[model samples]
Target chain A: MTMKRLINDPYDVVEEMVEGYVKAHDRYVKMCDLEEAQGRVVVAKDAGTKDKVGVVIGGGSGHEPLFIGYVGENFADGVVIGNINTSPSPDPCYAAAKAVDNGKGVIYLYGNYAGDVMNFDMGAEKADEEDDIRVETVLVTDDVVSSENIPDRRGIAGDFFVFKAAGAKAAMGADLDAVVAAASKCNDNTRSMGVAMSSATLPSKGGPIFDMEDGDMEIGMGIHGEPGVRRGKIEPADAVIDEIMDPILKDLPYEAGDEVYVLVNSLGATPVLDLHICYRRVAQILEEKGIKVHRALVGPFACSMDMAGMSVTLCKLDDELKELLDYPCDTPYFTQVK
Target chain B: MTMKRLINDPYDVVEEMVEGYVKAHDRYVKMCDLEEAQGRVVVAKDAGTKDKVGVVIGGGSGHEPLFIGYVGENFADGVVIGNINTSPSPDPCYAAAKAVDNGKGVIYLYGNYAGDVMNFDMGAEKADEEDDIRVETVLVTDDVVSSENIPDRRGIAGDFFVFKAAGAKAAMGADLDAVVAAASKCNDNTRSMGVAMSSATLPSKGGPIFDMEDGDMEIGMGIHGEPGVRRGKIEPADAVIDEIMDPILKDLPYEAGDEVYVLVNSLGATPVLDLHICYRRVAQILEEKGIKVHRALVGPFACSMDMAGMSVTLCKLDDELKELLDYPCDTPYFTQVK
Candidate 1:
């Protein structure tokens, strides 16, 4: 047996690491004690106008700053952190929503995954039964790879849009229904695709979560290190960017004069230069196609630890969506907004 | 051997990683050339000047985002990255110093090690001769642990003050000489001590860079994973913090009403919660001592890869130092700077 072959159980590792993680990053977050705050995302009491709409988002634990990282801004009232991509308990979701719920109601946004849906849906039901709160769901299905082979694409990292739109609406004091509608619209208009030169080692195993050769990469791996659409020889950076973003552009059938918010996400390992180079080229490609790119983000947005690769997510937008996308935000991993 | 590593050639790993390092984190850094700029820190030419003084700090490679990571507004004008603390050749240091020599003249701040002192002094001499620049230097010697009760106290992880004081001064634009003087002052009042629960593993090694017992850690390990003053069984978190910070606080001869800047640096493997919990007790101790801590930073600044445990650095500051410490900065490994 390999030396690192963990002595304890794998199931126990997440909780242990998170315990360590929480201890380390606790400066940035407070794991909502389901027993205490119930469903609020912010550790403190509601400071944002409760009368305005509320945005809620979340998923598994591995995406440290994603769901939890986005909590401080106007984006989400709460983000339910669970196991790696596994949904949090209904209690936590319900508590987070209930905690943030104003007279206007709450909007729940998330990546498209069976577990998140089931658990979040349950949480919404629980919130409804306990308080006079209306909760709506908007699922982000951005992974073009999962969608290529499968009819329903697995949600990757495009949930960022839902948060932006919902947050903008909430910040504007829009009604809960309007917030939900805007979030849903953003989700529908968004699409993403990713390529990975290597798989992230499971935090527990400390080895490849999945397998690939030294020179090979999966052209459409999921955020959870899920299997991608195509596995082949590693290609040039330019070619890789094309491969990753082409489908995202096409699936949405983006056309000339259509404005969109583009994000080139590095899933760990891939350095900023590589990401910037890829994004610079990707932007040029879209520019050649006459796509009116309003804004762009290239960084480690949603990362799989130590995985060397990238994902391209584009959200087709108009004036309303663009404004929402430009809203301010502050979190552990992301910031700009007040 | 345990497999899975991030670098190729062990000898070239530091340099190779530095290449990707600058390329990856140049977002906040306005100007840096990895290929030509090798061997020294590269500062942005047009970084906004603060009315306060400016501080320039650096060290070796592999501790990325540390030396280079803090180069931004109110932080550092330039950082001179050494070859894993071996100190880059004098030319690169001069080049870097020139790039960051805001009209105020830049202070070359760093740890107080023989290699660093010799190289920086040489770099300073070169800067003076070639560019009509007068550079200042400060050596950080915070380790209370002697090399086995010897006279030599190798500079440990407390170089953080060099960055803070310089960053603060640079933000204020105190002109080069004043900033240099202030940074030197901060260093004079600064002291640090560290303990490693385990050894840091280099990415290329796929094994610990140094050996240690599962239940033991060196109480005064240096940033390069050098042996500490003493090795003993791992103790409770409270005890660990006391052991690390108590000596630092005492060595500074800290008194009541003295304001200070506190930095708890992780040698890598140490998780966040433990750092915070360490902070919790440490903060209380300082309060009881009647020290007015104007600013506090608790995170991984100078890391020893994934080495578990932490170090504490305390810089006794006056009002001028407080003003400098309040400056804003942005880099990859650090954020929430205001």
Candidate 2:
């Protein structure tokens, strides 16, 4: 085992990460004080904004800045953090809804995972039965290679755009229903596919969760080391991007006149230099298709710890989607200024 | 050579990077029009902001978002990009000064390295002889382990704070002398130390820049895989922090009641979860010492492309430094709204 992690007590990685996260981003977030969710829930300080629906997001941990770091002003109102690559408990999910519930209600947003669906749904049930708070859900399904059925597709980096759109809609004084619609709209328009060069090291296990031959690459692999469409010797960046982008662009049926927001994300170990190199290809492809790029974000937004890989996400943009994505927000890992 | 980098034509990495950078961040930056510096210089779109002293920063290519990512509103006015782990040529450096020069002079800020000093000085002299633009410089020397003499020390992630201070000072309409002083003061108060568990891969070489056993870590290494003070088996995060913080705290003579702005930066491959875990220990240590943390930034601000390592930087704070550091600025990688 050759894990390179800066952590103590591998079992306590989650708790320590939360403590450190809240401390480092104290200006934007805080631990949930609610007894039921005490440590598991991280809430934005500006949550429960007047007349706005509560935007609660969560999933497994390890993909840092994803489920937790997005909780901030005009973004996620609260987040339920889980163990690395595992779903959160139902209690924390319920507690997240409780903590962020303004009079307008709450909307639960996350990727389409079986464990998450089972857990968050139960939490929503508890919220409805125990407290009369209305809780809605919008599962992000944007990974085109995951499934032929669009609803069964697993969310990947496109979760960023879906979350941002939902957050912005809620911040604009939308109700739970409207926020859910916005999340669904963004998820429908978003598509992501990734190539993993290596597997992420698991802290508690003290080794990589899976094995990936060093010189090989797996196209369309999920963040948690799930199987992708193909495994072969690594190819040049442009070729790999062309392979991945084809299905995404075709699946969305994105037309030449369409506009998009591009995100070239690093899966933990990939560097910004390489990410930009990949982005250059994505730009070229978009230009060739006559598709206009509204904005481009190149860096690690979602990641697998110590994993070497990259993902490309495209969020087809309309006037409303563009405004929602451009709305200002600030968090520990991401920030946008008006 | 089990390296996994996604780039094309290794020789063209720098040009492609600059092209991708300008395209992705068109809102904040533009390509320098000077034919001699055509693709080598990236200047802030708002450079030459009315009467404000120009803040020019640059170093090499691998450290993306450092020199170029910072060229934006109220930050670095211009950047001279170079090849990987190399310095920019004198012509581009001179062009950067001319491009960003408002009526006030340009201030060149970068890590203190022999190659960079020789090249930028030549550029400064050329600017003076040709364009009559007075360019002042303040080299950042914050890596505590580099040298015994302050000015002889190499710069590391601490470059972020020094450049930020200079940018803020310049944005506030400070004269070249005042901006230089601000950069000097920030550099004097800042200290950094890093650990490298593995070497960063070089694009051109298509392999690791150096080699080490998987579980071993070197303390106080520079970003370019430079040697450090100690090498041993990997230790717990807290233990590692203790080993690193002791020298930084003692070198700065940081005492009780001192306030500091802390930055726990990843050297590429390290994840945000690990960074926060490291920051927790830093906070604990400061608390034990009765030192107050004014603010903390935990992420990959400066990186050594896919290297498995992390660095901690602390800027001892005063009222002036605090105000300048907190001032709002926007760039592709970083943004402070308030």
Candidate 3:
């Protein structure tokens, strides 16, 4: 059992985590009890701005500070939680929309996955049927390596940037269609690539979700042990970043004279020391390419439990995107300063 | 080797990390190169507040946000870097004071350790003799389990609260004596205890810093593999918190009607999910004791770089301590909204 997780009962992880999260961040969020939500929804206490569209985001657990961590002022209004790596049921997803809607309508945003799409779509249908509240959906497809086609790529850490942009738009009183467009536009421009040196430990499984040799690494690996582009012996930090950046750069064709926002994110278990070392290389690469780094974020924005690796996310910037990304927002895990 | 860390050359980690940190947080800090300071100091760009005492804090390198992460607005103005698990050299310690000092004076705050004391003292002596800058020191001895005598106990996560108090005082234009007094008072009221399930992997050694079986855990362990009070099989989160909180509470004698600032810190690989679960119990115990939790912080405040464990720190508070703790601060790793 290479899994070194420190959880108590495997079955109680989600509930306990929810209880703990709300208690620690009660100033920002509260537990919501919709008829069939089963307490799986955590909504921002001050949600439902009078004329603003409600922003509801969610997905599986284990990725702390992702869906739930983004729920706060000027961010997502609520988050629907799921079990470890599993999608939420339809009821909670529907309840999330019902919880935050203020007559301007609601938007459901999540990473692109078969399970999440199915569940959230069912939720949206239920919301429209039961209350006649319109709900829009935006699927984040930002992992450039997952698929070559624009809409098929899976979302990874790029979810942070895309969600922030859309949330900012919604907070600014954008209508439902405009908010969806903002999210879709952000997703289209964002690109992410990651490498995993070790698999994340699953609480219930009581072992590694997948296995790799001690000195090996998988480049372009998905957050949930999904297959990557290549597996080989682990390389130096510089060499690894070189390998990762080439594809991300070419996919977007991020060229000279381009300015961008950067996010060098830890998958988990990787220390801040190494993340910065990785960021140093990223900055050097961007400089060499004649690209200007507008603003940068380096930490565990999205993580896969204690997985030992990291990812680099680049969101090419325009005036609107920059303002949205830099908007002041606060949550337990992330805060942006004015 | 169960320990898997992602870094480049082990010997160059400190230098590379410094390079990465300054670049990633260019908004708040900059790398300093003082002729006598040996280029191991990172100072806040907004340091050198006129008429205010300079606050310099540092220790070994493994604790990421602790010694370095807290150096910014209204906090420690500078940090001296050291090798992994080793105290910083005398030159850099002196350099940090020189970099941040304005007209008033400087205050050096760090955990009570022999190596840090010897090195920082040499630096302070050099400052006084060569430059005529008054330098004062306050040793934080908050790890109640490290020793029965208050001054002999080691410093741990409580470093955060103490440094913040002193830094806030300095930023408020307190002279050196007043700043040191504030730091000393915070240290007197703070206590911490931690459990390590697995040892942190040494970058230079390429293995665990110490030995422990996979199923085993040590209670009251210090950050750098110091001997703990008890070793036993892993327990549930509640039971483990019960064991940790008993000593901390007893040592401080935190009583009913008292208020405290709680920090449930992940040593490294423990993740936020588990930290919150742990915080739930800490809150439960404090509530049952009629101890009012003025505020709570749960996350990887001080980490051991992928070491699987956590620690709890409580600063029994008064009005002064509460005001200082809640004072506005902005750094890459920590921020306060007020």
- Top-lDDT candidate index: 2
lDDT of 1 by residue, A149-210 (tens): 53377777687777878887887888877877888788888888888876665645645677
For B1-338, candidate 2 gives per-residue lDDT tens digits of 48888888889988888888888889888999987675899988877656889888999888876778888887888899889999999999999998889778999999999999999999999889998999999999999999999989999999999999999999898999999999999999999999999999998888989888879999999999888999999889989998999999998777799999999999999899998889999999999999999999988888999898899999999999999999999988889987
lDDT of 3 by residue, B1-338 (tens): 64466678988888888888888888888887687767689999877756688999998888887788888888889999888878999999888888888968899999999999999999999888877889999999988889888888889999999999998998887878889889999999999999999888898888889998877889999999899999988888889999999989888666689999999998887877788888888888998999998888888888888788999999999999999999988888888876
The full ranking of all candidates by DockQ, starting with the best, is 2, 3, 1
Which pairs of residues clash in candidate 2, taking residues 3 or more apart in a chain or in different chains? Answer: none
* DockQ-better candidate, 2 vs 3: 2
lDDT of candidate 2 over A143-181, digit per residue (tens): 889999999889888989999999999999987788889
**Candidate 2 CAPRI assessment class:** medium
Query: Is candidate 1 or 3 superior in lDDT?
Result: 3
- DockQ-based class of model 3: medium
lDDT of model 1 at residue B325?
A: 63
- The parts of candidate 3 lying over 4 Å away from their true place are none
Per-prediction TM-score to the true structure, in the order listed: 0.74, 0.99, 0.98
* Per-model RMSD to reference: 5.9, 1.0, 1.4
Instruction: Name the 10 consecutive residues with the lowest summed lDDT in model 1 chain A.
Output: A1-10
